[model samples]
Target: MTEESPGAPGGGRPEDVRHRLVEVFGERVSASVPLAGLTTFRTGGAADWLLETSDPADIVAAVRVTRALDLPLTVFGGGSNVLVGDGGVRGLVVRVRHGAISAHGTSTVRADGGVTLNGLVRWAIQRGMAGLERWAGTPGTVGGAIYGNAHFDGLMVGDMVAEVGLVDRTGSILRVSGSEMAFGYDESRVQHTGEFVLWANFDVAAGDPAKLRAAARESLGFRKRTQPLAQASAGCVFQNPRVTDDSLSGGVPRTAGALIDGAGLKGCRVGGAVVSTIHGNFIVSDGAATSADVRTLIEHCRSAVVDRFGVLLREELVYVGVFG
Candidate 1:
């Protein structure tokens, strides 16, 4: 039956939807799946249905079925930089797990969407490929990295991408060149258009393996030292404010952490969430933290920074599911 018509036996009951999906996807589909364990932040309620699959075919199938059923769908990768709500997600959440990579040459590699940014960096470094060395500790999958134009130390993942493989809204597979990606500050065309990245080819450059490894190590070390890597935080809470001629910060990119620190928000706490003393940009959860706690802390910091510096901070973290 088309989405316009109710499904068999139950007239489009949610349970009927789950049962129909089970017939198509088998054990890969789960109900009321707890979400906190799936994310880096380790907080949230659950997903009504979770499809865990390493097969691109399965991913596409899940997407197609959900669209046909008119069910809300969310694609979850190495969950980071997102806060799932306390009330849980209403429909289907497809969790990608197909992390495979292939080296085309010393200067090029291909990666599946589920491959972590850190994994791609290592793969390239191992093959003596350069250009991704500094993203060693960046969280999230290659798909997410591309979607958000993940960056560090003046370098961006988009710079290395040659092309992307995606499943569009209509479930057709297609390829788009890097130029067409329309990458910008923490944003990409895919993010705006709702295309799901399946894989990508990254064009790197030849480099010394030892040097690349050393560079990766140095970058990871710096992140570990400054950020609360051991803590339950969703990376940076806000995007760094751009510098302008009339900006409060001098004409250079201002760090979000510095702004929060300058605003005296470090160690500031609300519920089980606290801005990291080591790096004010991160709001580490104290295990018992709820989504509300994190959201409140984030808002408090945003407001405080605005009040103190007269510059409004924009959140880098995206909200998932629902919350109060």
Candidate 2:
């Protein structure tokens, strides 16, 4: 079957699609899998079809099958930056969990897409490598990090990337260099191309272990002090406004958190979702919060900021599945 091939059996039927997937993927595929436990927010519904594998080959095969069957495909990494809707996802969800890291030549380390950013940081620190130590407390997988050009302080993950191995929409594997990634503030070319990252090689430098550990610890400490790490949240709710209108803020910091705080939205609540008093940008759940609750709170914060400062804040959190 080809990318333009017709759907198999009862076209677009859920059971038919599941059966076809089972035939192709065997035990690797599951039906109606719960999604809440798979994500950092710990909320949302199920995936109609789910494929969890540690093999890049399996990832490519799944994409091919889904494309041939005319089913929608979604790639989930560490599930740290998305809000899956309660209505659930309509098709297959692919989560790659292979996290092997190896030295590429002398100055590069190749990490499987599933490797947690923090895991990569620790790996580099343990080996006395320096570049990743500054991102010690970052969440999600390397794939997700690169997809969003994950940043800390003033540095972006893209800055250290050497190359990326990805499965493009056509199910063809390709190696894209860092320069070709088109990384920007919270974005990469893959987002537009619908390509799936299988692994990435990052540039590293030799460093003293003690110094690397110290830097990693400092990054972790800063996150613990500033963010509500204890609560269930999807990191930052909004991207910091890129361009600030001076007439609106009157010298207030243009950061998303600062704008929300200055708008006096701290401790604001919608159902079980509340804006963290510790950091205005984080919307934490009180264990029982629903996706709807968090989403509503996000809108409330956005509205408040726009009304007060004439600045419409954009979301940093990605929405997955479907909402009611």
Candidate 3:
């Protein structure tokens, strides 16, 4: 699929590729870098070549280089809600490091993809921007948030996105509006296609600073109370189940955690992978978890829920590399 692109650069020898990359990116590029430390789960293998960049220009350049060299590439963002296999990623990994945040107007703010949702919310609140306070304690970068259409309580990150700048697999930067993104619940066009967001503009309205700060605090407090915040988990392990029978779910929303908990799988473990006692949807790694262990635990939870309630749970996390 990669080679078919029009004007795709010809394949090159390994030595030539390495020399070219070193000349272009210098010390920022490294080989055989372990990725577990870079992710929220803290349980992955290595990336073949990891390019860390805090500049959008760097991200673009890395993409262009990889494409020109005909190498496999992955755009790794905040590393939240993603599980990596122990086998590691095969080729070039471009880690987005662009973290700048600035206001374009009184009611709008622009942020780099590497900016965390937690940071973005605080930035918005400080600037009297009103739309993102609900995500005060959300995990992942702005790019990851947009990729998954991140949400909390009744608010979603997609709701406030005004525009996004993306780098296509062919290394072209394209700007598009929010609606053009094909946003859905915990899904977006980015997930379907491989386009990577470099930065985004969010639309917010005039808000009282004091009120926004208080609301942000309250939202954060709620997360700390309800989630296993202190543990190492890749956010929610599963997306909320869709069920038509309201009575089975207590006439309320049917969440993945509730279903798993109801199936009596909380604290169920396979090696270091255990369902979080506080939130059944999360599988926390106790510093010794393996990709296989987590996969087994998730399967156990899925089977139990399906056996008990006839509902299939979808995963919210994306897995990179080869899964056993």
Question: Each candidate's TM vs. the true structure?
Answer: 0.93, 0.94, 0.92
Q: State the lDDT at 151 in candidate 3.
A: 78
RMSD of each: 3.9, 3.9, 4.1
Q: Distance from true position, residue 184, model 3, in Å?
A: 0.5
Instruction: Kindly report which residue stretches of model 1 are placed more than 4 angstroms away from their true locations once superposed.
Output: 1-11, 249-253
Sort order, lDDT high to low: 2, 3, 1
Query: Which lDDT value does model 2 have at 84?
Result: 88
Better of 1 and 2 by lDDT: 2
What is candidate 3's CA lDDT for residue 259? 87
Question: Which candidate achieves the best TM-score against the true structure?
Answer: 2
Instruction: Report the C-alpha lDDT of model 3 over 1-324, residue by residue, as the tens digit.
Output: 121221122436656766777888998788778898889899977877788876788778877888778877777777878899887776677787548999996878999998888888888888788988878878778888899998788677888999999988888899989999999788889988888888999998999989999998899899899999888899899988655654455443388988889899999999999999999999999989998899989989989998987778889999996566
lDDT of 2 by residue, 1-324 (tens): 122112222237666776789898998888778898888888898887788877778878987988888788889888889898877776788877656899876699999999989988888888888899999899889988988899889899999998999998779999999999999988899989999999999999999989999999999999999999998888998988876355444675678999999999999998888999999989988888889888998888888887888888889989997776
Ranking of all candidate structures by their TM-score, best first:
2, 1, 3
Give per-residue CA lDDT, model 1, range 87-121, as digits (tens). Answer: 77777888886578998766668999988888888
**lDDT at position 305, candidate 1:** 80
Which pairs of residues collide in candidate 1? Answer: none
Candidate 3: deviation at residue 88, Å? Answer: 0.7
